[model samples]
Structures are given as structure tokens and as C-alpha cells.
Target: GPGAPAWAYAARRHWAALSPPLTGWMGHADPFAFAPEWQPAPGVRRLLVGTPPILAMTALAAGVASFDGIDIAAAEAKSAALVSVFAALVAARCPGVGVDAPPQPRHGAQLVVRHPHGRRVMAALIECGVIGDFRPPDRMRFGFPALYTRFVDLWDAVDVLAGVIDTGAWQDARFDRLGKVS
Candidate 1:
């Protein structure tokens, strides 16, 4: 009775409930069986390399995340330049959009814009094929990775964003409803 598997099963269930949905893909096994106390279960690879690898590369190139102490001066300069341009545009056109004066660097080359109509603005951008993440009640975030993102792309996105704000297109009732995933 001392070695009963009931305790382990209960612990597993508790962990599963707290973890993300993707954890199910990792399979059921004694996680502590590995030497390091944690390791991916054998033969249970979902996003081991492909997308994560690409995103890692992108983050490194964006000068937001460092790799092996190597500093990317160009990426840093480019990010600053882009942020300056974005801040200027946002300030000039969309007065309601709040842009930080001294932008925080560790945020990974992204602008954290807070607006009254954050969700609606995000929805409008999505409609225009400009994807952005929203923090409910009023915060929209935009990340510009210097890897494949170009100035033209940013300009175009800003143009669409400006149009949305100017036209008050984000006032749509559809944007007020919450979706499965924000």
C-alpha cells in the first residue's frame, strides 16, 4: 500500500490541469525519470525544431534577445530607428495611442501601445491583415522583428492603422465580443 500508484496518478492529473493544452501532446510518464529532473518524454515531439527555431532566429536578429553574448549592433540600431519612426507616426496621427517617450529595450523590439479602443483597433488591424496582440480593456502590442520585417512593411501597417483610427472603423459591435482566444 505504501507504493500505491494512486498518489502519482493524482499528482499527474493536478499537473495536467494546471499546464497548457500542449502538455497532453508530451504524453504521460514519470517526468522525474530523467537525470536532470526534467526532459521531454521520448518520441513525443510536436514543435521541437521548426517554428521555435525560426522564432529564435528572428528574436536574435531583432536584437531583443541575445545569443551566446554576441551583440548585434545593426539590429539594435535598426530597432531604435524603427521605433522612433513608429512613435513619431503614432503621436502625429493617432493622438489617442500612447507611445512611451523612452521606449523600454528589453521588451523585444516591440511597442506597447495603450488605447481606449485597444480591442477594436486590434480587430481592425486584423481585418487589414496587420496582426497585433491585445491586452483587454485597452492595450495593443506590436512587435517588429528586423529579421524579415522591412520599413515598407511597417509603413504599410501604420497606414492601415491610421486609416482605421481616422475612419473610426474600430467602433464595430463585432469587436466588443470576446473570442475563444485573444
Candidate 2:
């Protein structure tokens, strides 16, 4: 138990439950693993298995994850910048008409936030193609995945969203009433 995490064996063992070595990210171990609390069935094999595409995709992700931190940071900067610009446009065109959810951040260089509004507004954005991620309570998140988002695309995304709110297009009768993962 002494000196047992990557930083030491103890820390590794600590985070092991939440983060697995799925992509070589897990190297921590604890002696209590074989205890009754945890056990792996042996001599069992499933007939349906081996998805090569999944393995290939995972390999691609691991390779990307191994990119230098500086490069990732640069990519993130571009993405956040573009997304922030979009959020600024949304804020500018559709000034908050006053929502009871506490005043939210209007805009910033690296923050692409929007204020809470009715559910129709959210579904409208999704239908427009910007994969908005929904969070609990009332927050919509957008992931401008750096490797592929362009500034023009970002502008267009927000412009369309502005139109949705301006014309009540989001009132289309199909969005789920309940909030989901963002």
C-alpha cells in the first residue's frame, strides 16, 4: 500500500474506479482488487465479438490524445475563439429579455455561454445542425471540436440560431420537454 500510485500506487488505486485503463490511461492498482468486492468471471467467451472498426477508432483517439499539450492548447484556443465570437453574435442580436435564471455571462474570448431560455429555443438550434449539448437545470453546451470548426461556420451557426428565436421557429412540435445531458 506504500508508494503504490503512479504519483504513487495509492492515487492510482484511488482513481481506478472512475477512470479505467481503456486507453492506457489506467496504470494504478490496489491489492484489494481480488477481494470479494471485485471479481472477473473466468473461462467465459462471447460468441459475438471483435469489432475492428471500434478498435481502429480507439487507436485513432489514443493517437490524438498523445498529441503534445501545446498543440492541443493552440487548437483549443482557435475553437474557443470562434465559438466565443458566435456566442457574442447571439448575445448581440438577441439581448436577454430578462430570464429568472440569474444573469449569465454575455460573452468573452474563451467562453461561449448563453442564457437560459425556454426549451423550444434549444431544439431549434439542434435542428439547425449545431450539435448543442444540454446540461441540467438549463444550459446548452456547444462543442466546437477544434480540428474541424471554421470561423465562418461558427458565424453561420449563431446567425441561424438568432433567426430561430426571432421567428419562433423553435416552437416546432417535437422537442423533448425534459432536459438531458449536455
The deviation in Å at residue 60 for candidate 2 is: 2.6
Clashing pairs in 1: none
TM-score of 2: 0.55
- Candidate 1 lDDT, 7-95, residue by residue in tens: 12234435434432333223434433544333334442321211234555565566544344545788787887777777777878776
Model 2 error, position 5 (Å): 22
Which candidate leads in TM-score?
Answer: 1
Error of 2 at 129 (Å): 1.2
Candidate maximizing lDDT: 1
Instruction: Give all TM-scores, in the order shown.
Output: 0.59, 0.55
For model 1, what is the alpha-carbon lDDT of residue 52? 30
